[model samples]
Target: MVFRTLFSVIVVFDIVSKQIIVIRDKLPYLKAIVQYKGELNKDYPDTYTWAKFLELGKSVEDSVVDNIIKEQKPGQCAVLIYTSGTTANPKGVMLSHDNLTWTTKALLDTIGSDKAEEVTKCTISYLPSTHISGMSSLAAG
Candidate 1:
């Protein structure tokens, strides 16, 4: 019984740790529109606009990430999107795990892990995730 229990615990930890590693690779893409309770509750001022940011974040959490994670695929189709920001100009962009990996490698060539390691803790600072910069940042961790 003791052996079985220990084995089960190890299995569970291994599974969860694998998931965290996958997410860690793509951590840059997710930006929090609102302050988290755990991090913000200490030595932080609560402002009126913060409420709105939370609302927006909740909306996104419900619609985007929730829906995306619901699908489990060994390898998924690439998501192709267009970038149209404040400027009326729009351009097509395609993203997949392959693209993300290649881009990350290119980035690594320039800055290396110096900046990447320091950016462990990241938050989303912008609204309207329909832009290329936002999507690229989100896709390539």
Candidate 2:
């Protein structure tokens, strides 16, 4: 698909087993590694299990985070969401950093900051990470 090719690489993490079957069908080699060796793609930006991903995070230095913050601009793409494609095939839609921030800020402004702070906050995420409402909930919390 266009979106898949847009990136030089793509990694799907089956942290909660949600994506395992999809990976098995599309990239059997990755599934084989998981099944036979209990191993995952060890390269940067490749698929890995939740625990392995966390372990690999240890190797990332603080500079990486700093650089991310320093380099990121509001217009840059922050999330990719796919349409249900009721009329046609699914298409990838890029959501910018400003879009997400604006959504969260709007939610807070609508709810009123004082009332929001007084209420206990909880966030539930259903992944592919592009779920805007989920992102808004997390950001607001």
Best candidate according to TM-score: 2
Q: Report the lDDT tens digits of candidate 2 across residue range 1-141.
A: 432334422334335234444444454234221212245534323455555556756999999989998998989988766676799997887889899999888878887867766542653456434477667767777
Per-candidate TM-score against the hidden true structure? 0.31, 0.63
* Candidate 2 all-Cα RMSD: 6.4
Q: Rate the local accuracy (lDDT) of all candidates.
A: 0.42, 0.59
Give every collision pair in model 2.
Answer: none
CA displacement after TM-score superposition, residue 99 of candidate 1 (Å): 1.5
Collision pairs in model 1: 29-138, 31-124, 32-124
RMSD of 1: 18.2
Cα error, residue 124 of model 2, in Å, equals 7.6
Q: Which candidate has the highest lDDT of all? A: 2
How many angstroms is residue 70 displaced in model 2 relative to the true structure, after the best TM-score fit?
0.6
Give candidate 1's TM-score.
0.31
